[model samples]
Target chain A: MVIERASVTANELIAEGIFQMNVSAPKIAGENPSPGQFINISVIDSWFHPLRRPMSIAGREGESLKIIYKIFGAGTRLLSEFPVGSFIDLLGPLGNTFELTEGATPVLVGGGVGLAPILWFDETLRSNGIDHTTIIGARHSGEHFLEHCPKEGFILTTDDGTVGIKGTVLPTIESICLEMENPKLFACGPEPMLKAVKQFAEKETVLCELSVESYMGCATGICQGCAIEHKSSSISEHSYHERFSLVCLDGPIYNAKDIRFP
Target chain B: MSCNLTVEIAGVSFKNPIFVASGTFGYGLETQELTDSSSLGAVITKSITRHPREGNPPPRIVETPSGMINSIGLANMGVERYIDTVIPRIDEIGTAVITNIAGFSIDDYLYVMEKLEACKAPICGYEINISCPNVEAGRMEFAVDPELTGRLTESLREVTKKLLIIKLSPNVTGIASIALAAEQAGADAVSAINTVFGMSIDTQSRSPYVQTNVGGLSGPAVRPVGIACVYKISRKVNIPIIGIGGITSANDAVEYILAGASVVQVGTANYKNADTARSMIDELELYLAENGIENLSELTGGVIPNE
Candidate 1:
């Protein structure tokens, strides 16, 4: 990972409280970044705060990168207020990337703000000439981010029934898997939604990988801030060789079977 | 005008007087992509014990407004595996090394030391970590009393002829007495002020945030505690002091040095900026140059005492 000052080319409101920022960073744009890798962004002119906000790479457009940030706290709120053509500090592309598999039908599922990273994953699958299915959900109608997404072969769900199906993503997940011949599961969302997807994939004997949204510190693995418990015998196979792994280092992306949920 | 930022402690010279504090930098392998480890004065490895520890449960770290509290519980890959696997990686970095040793008992420490002695890794010194706040063992207990601190330092003194620097805990009544004890027991230098004791509770969950109920607090919030400790301990012992607390910039380092710390360690600030130590080193040089000072040693103990 390298630290670079990225200039904001476009910062627009895609949804309420959620802003899509397109930045021109040669250092980040120069790398072959996969889905699920993130950038740790610092609020401009805010030195009192001692932590950076971790924003996932929404998509990549030639020499520019896209990040969808939610106005959660002071740091992010300040970040949303920055005018276009301003330089912002970003330490990226930090963390491990998602493994793209061939010959298997890539199934992209996400809920709420977790759909941010899935957007990039969708772009990658399409650019590789791979046929895929996209499943998305959010809290309500206006909260969903479906901008510029392909309309065909898409399933939409929401909690309040204002958009599509009046249910959670878990119930719709099973029927979607049954229709596909060779389904590969990839999901990112709330904790309960991720757990549901993991169980569905395991029960159906399908491969599943999850991008967890755990709180982070350095995003570089030193702070040990984003640690999650894992099944002891799971991650020992890889070079990580640890019982517990940092979300920033070992993964923001983990195989569904490898981690032990609390 | 030459700005001399290097410092010599216990016959070992450091490139600068800033180090990435233990627990912040994990064995120097984790942050290699972010910053060059060799740029700092000396790299201190995370606390290594005899056996592998899995550390604490989930929610290990929580960040407050100004600082953070961590209860990692000294989880590490045992000394044998460390000397076998980790040492080779650290040895490749072209910088001086100091292995921070943390154990529950004296033998646990001695066993780690004995194993390290046989290893060919070029570890420059051993910073005796008798003051880790996250563990529920006798490690922090050793620094609470002067006699215990003295005996532990003296025992390790018999084991290795290498440089020995005792790191002090801030959760003590008389920190000066503990420093004096370590110095009298043949310690080469002392690291003043480990993390102070603290805890946080989640109001919505109605339970402790960290599994251990309490943890070590670091960052700018703990800087005052560290400055006071360095001021008190410097008068009691003549050993060089490595001040570690909430050092973020050159100004924080100046406060510690003026308070009689020979050098300083950057801890919690590293979480936000991976190269806090390296940046602080450059800032120190700039400060020296701006003040028309040639030697960095002139800042140490420059604070005036009110008569």
Candidate 2:
């Protein structure tokens, strides 16, 4: 992927603390950016904020790509202050893309800010004329942000019973999984929810792919900042010593069963 | 008028003074799609040892306010594997390639160098990686001791006809004396400050951020210490010094150059931008051109001390 100095075309709050920014990243957003990969972005002229914070690619419209992020650290805190005409430096389309088979029915699942990456996943499925279902959950009604998505075949859940469902995405996922035949799942969200989704997907015997968010230094492969452990690797299934993989290189997405979530 | 960024250190000429620090840039192949590798002065391969290394466990790096600490434990394939698979790709980079060697003892260092001497690639020289703070043995152990540093440099000087540059650790009390020991042992040049020893704990988790609690800290956090080492060593010895620590922009490179470094390697900044080394090369040249400076050799050791 290329490092592009994409101008900030639009930056506004979508939910309580979540923001959706449209950036002019032609090469980085690419003609067809796969769903799971993300962008490492930072404030235009701030060398003080040295590391580029990783943001999931929410959507791509025409010449610009959309990024959905929460103000978690110093980098994001600085980015929230940029005006509409300002520029945001980005290095991306990094990490591996979500894998979809030719005929596996798509089932999109997202939780909180994790839904950002899956927004692109849902769009890709819709564009491919694939019939799929979307299940999104947030902490409360104010945190919910899928108003622009289609009403039919969509499930929304909130913790305080202010949205589509009162509980987490787990119930909606179970019911949907039971209905859809040979559904292939794509999910990104909180660790606890991902753990539940992984369990649900496993029990239901459907294919599952997940994206994990780890604290990072370099979104590239060089710095071993973002590494996730696995039960087994390609080199060894039972080898105790080498059970690790880099989130920046091997994946931001892996099969539901491929990784053991903490 | 065209600017000449060419620099000759230890009888080896670099297209510029921008060498990518060992390990931070990872053999320089990953960023080929982002920028041309041949643009930088040189690409120093990751530190390699006699046997393969798995490195430290998970959480190898942690982000500080302005920099990062990594206990990457010289995580790399053995020397033979690197020479067979990675070096050829490095050979194609068409720029100066300096192999950074790491070992537990001088014999381990000698063994790796012997194998390196056999390789027919157009390698300009070797940078002895005696300064890494990530490992439990050999790296810092050899670097902190002036005698060990001298003996290693002296033995390495016996083998191979290539230029020898000793990388010094900043963990020692007297950075200058260790550098002098290296100079006396016949090193072509010395690269200062290979990460100051550091550690950070995740309070909430009640554990160390990295599996190995103590790692080598790099980036802008270590910049002053690195410059100080270069400055201190510059006075004690006359050999060229390759200043490394946390160099982000051209001004930082010039800071090291003014402090008496003939060359500078950009380390932790590469994490922020993969093309940092190339960008710094362009920035340094522009700084020279705009300032009406004809050559870069004049800037080396330009800093004047106060009486």
Number of the top DockQ candidate: 1
**Quick one: best TM-score, which candidate?**
1
Q: State the lDDT of candidate 2 residue by residue for B10-80, as single tens digits.
A: 67889899989988777667777777778889888888788876666677887776777787767677788
DockQ measured for candidate 2: 0.42
Give one digit per residue, the lDDT tens place, for model 1 in A1-262: 7888899999888876778899998898787677899988888544466778888899888778999877776778888877899998888887787776776787888887788788899878777777888888887878776632435556778788887776887777777778888788889888989989998888888888999977676787666667787766544422233778888888889999988778
Q: Candidate 1's error at B13, in angstroms?
A: 2.4
Model 1, which residues run further than 4 Å from truth? A44-47, A147-151, A234-241, B89-91, B132-140
Please, what are the lDDT tens digits per residue for candidate 2 over residues A20-56?
8898888785645677888887663645656778888
Of candidate 2 chain A, the 10-residue stretch with the lowest lDDT total is: A233-242
Error of 2 at A118 (Å): 1.1
Worst 10 residues of 1 chain A by lDDT: A232-241
